[model samples]
Target: MLLIVGAGFAGLSAALRARHLGVAVTVVAGRERAFDAPECLSLEGVRALHDCGLDARQLQLPPVREYISRWGESPMLSRAPPPGIPKNIMLGRVQLLRALRACATEEGVTFVEADELYRVLPTRQGLQLQFTGPVQELVLDASFAIDASGRAAVLARKLGVGRRTFDHLVAYGVRGPVHGLPEGVVHTFSVADGWVFAVSDSPGQAHVCFYTNGRLAGRVTEAKIMERVPYQIRSLMSDEDMWLASGVSAANASTSLLDVPGGTYWLACGDALQTVDPLSSSGITTALQQGAAAVSAAVASLSGNLEPMRAYWLESRAHFDSYVRNRNSFYGFGESAS
Candidate 1:
């Protein structure tokens, strides 16, 4: 039996693949909703979608481009926005979860809701999982445990896996309606505190986020952040327009910078292995791709051939490193936001 934690894109993908391989897979997801990606484009913009193999024809929205900012020392305008994306191409967190649930159920994967895993013990006969929920605490036995628990890295942290944090910058986001904006024109601007993003969800809905230092964090009032958008549009939004995961949500109506740690799992596929910046909009693309990657590794590991798993981990690490480098370079104004 295989036990997987979390049910985001990566977790769901892993469960689906494992079940297809005839393995008994069970998933434990904390919440049913996956946060929707902002309609906004990243500095590298949307063209990266093509690189990730997202089918453009399936989305019929027109492309929007504009002059954004340069990050590095050069004082010049950065031209050429990411390729414009069709509104239909983007899937909200709720829709993604529903789709994954359907796929996992059809594939015969066992899924449990609101169950939190507290412990994992790898024994001679397989692995044992201790979980707690509304019902009661239960123990599950499996041959292997895949920690798709994401940034929590519950299993990995317990096993002494270290983490690396990037520079001082935090991010907060709110999604709602906005008008009179180009579909593909995602704007990244610098303020006295840090950077702010204006992302479009559709013709009317938009996602606005601000990144500020810890000291300046307290001032990002919900009202001010909303005001960052057009006045007429701001009036149409409410506080609940934002979706914040625990620990990352703002309470004083301010934005916070979080530690950007490039994490890997002791064992597993998907986000448990690595996570990219939402700024790159590669979350879903990579989650789907990594799900396949994890399945390949898990099969190899099970067959006593660990080489494939190791290779997969190496490739994941290399790709994320490139991503970090690309982001730093873009912020420094060296490369086009590719």
Candidate 2:
């Protein structure tokens, strides 16, 4: 049996994939609520969901038709999907999580909710996990364990794996009702300090955020956020709209091949493995892809083949490096243009 931790896209995807392969899999989702900004599903992400038997349209996700981007003080530029490419979709983060949970349940994945992972013990055969909260004192064992715990890198940290964080990148944002943004369009505006991305998930409701250095984000006030955004977006902000703010380091990379793959009965996937820049808009896609790969690695490990795990680690690292290079190029272009 495989034990997958965390039930966001990565965990759910891994569970479903393992079950599809006839492996007994259980998911421990450590949180009850999924609180996040709206997510934009790239074309690859949409295809991945469909392959997993999930229909975003049936889930009532809003279609995103174009992107309007402005670098620094430059004029805004509009970009539509290229010919023959699939248009992206946008949906509230929590809504998407709920839909994914429902899909996983329908596919016979067992879910255990816990507030914390108290301990993890390595066994001769596999690993034992202890959970807290309603599952207090309960211990579960599995042939293989997967960590999909996002940027917290829950299992990785517990295993004493060092994390390399991109200190230069940080993001702060709020979600609330806003006006002036056209429905189905995502807007990104770069500023001297950082960049702002806003997308309307539903009529009159949008998630707006700023990506900047961690220090700058820490010092940024609500007033400063308003000033950084485009005038059209700034005009829409008002005291009446309740806004919630949160911040995090947006780019994190790990040498997973060196640090993760050689485990006898453990693997790490999704944001626990690496985090992408929001400007890349590939978080969900990366999570889903790695989740599926992790399952394959687990299955191969069960059969006494360690090559798959090594391969997956290498692939994940390469993907992360490529993303970092591209991110630097993108930010560099914005800087040079400014």
Candidate 3:
């Protein structure tokens, strides 16, 4: 049996693939914390979803048309399709999770909703996990474990995996009704020491956020950040007629990677393995694909072939290195924000 943790896109994709391969898989989900922001996916990412047996078309909504960014003194840059998005393709959290869970359930994947994981005991047969939900405590066994626990890397950390974080990037912002903006435009603006992003996830419901150093997050307020927003974005809420949800929130948007993707009978995928800047637009894209990657390595490891696990580590390292280079290159137009 295979045991998986977390229920985000990464976890669900892993479960969907594993069961399709006729593996007995059980998923332990502590919680699903959806980020209140817009998630972008490239064409390749859409293909990955279809590979995972999900109806990718259901999520294609709100329709993003172009990407606009104003950084340093460079002329405002605009990109279409590839960066703009090909068609009706904006991935929302609700639609994604609902579709993934439905697919997993129909395929005979067991789901255990738990409050927290208490113990991971190893036996000759497999790894035994003990967790508690609201009503009762439960235990399950599996030959291998796959961690999709997001940035926490819960299972990976417990198994002695170390993480190398590249920066102290954090994002603080709010989401609500934003009006009088070019419909379906994703905007990014470089401010005093950070950047601001604004986009309509659905109709008039806009998701906006400010990204900067963790230290500056606490010192800045929504009004102050809004003040730094470029005229184009500020125009969205600049009018007295415009209103929005108050109280900005914070979440880690740092770039980090795991020292080892996996060892022995366990491995990690998605945010648990590595994280990149949200602006890179690859986090969710890579996450949607990590499920299959994790399954391939885990299945090989379960069969006593450690080569796949080693290869997985090497691939993860290479991917992270390449991502950093690409991210840095993309930011070349802008001065350091933090």
Among the numbered candidates, top TM-score falls to 3
Candidate 1 runs further than 4 Å off: 36-88, 182-192, 213-215, 218-266, 333-338
TM-score of 1: 0.71
Candidate 1 lDDT over 131-241, as tens digits, reads 787577868786666767766666565555665444334567666555555555566655444555665646766666666554445566645543443333343344334
Cα distance off (Å), candidate 3, residue 272: 0.3
Model 2 local distance difference test score = 0.72
Score residue 310 of candidate 1 by CA lDDT.
74
Distance from true position, residue 34, model 3, in Å?
Answer: 2.1
Worst 10 residues of 3 by lDDT: 73-82
List, residue by residue over 63-181, the lDDT tens digit for candidate 2: 78677765645322223212443355777778877888888898899988777777888998998988786735668898899999887777767777776665445566666777677
lDDT of each: 0.56, 0.72, 0.74
Candidate 3 residues lying further than 4 Å off, grouped into runs, are 74-88, 230-233, 238-245, 332-338
TM-score of each: 0.71, 0.86, 0.87
Residues 127-238 of candidate 3 have per-residue lDDT tens digits of 7778787798878787999989889888877767799887788887677677765668877776666677877766676777778766665576656655655564556664
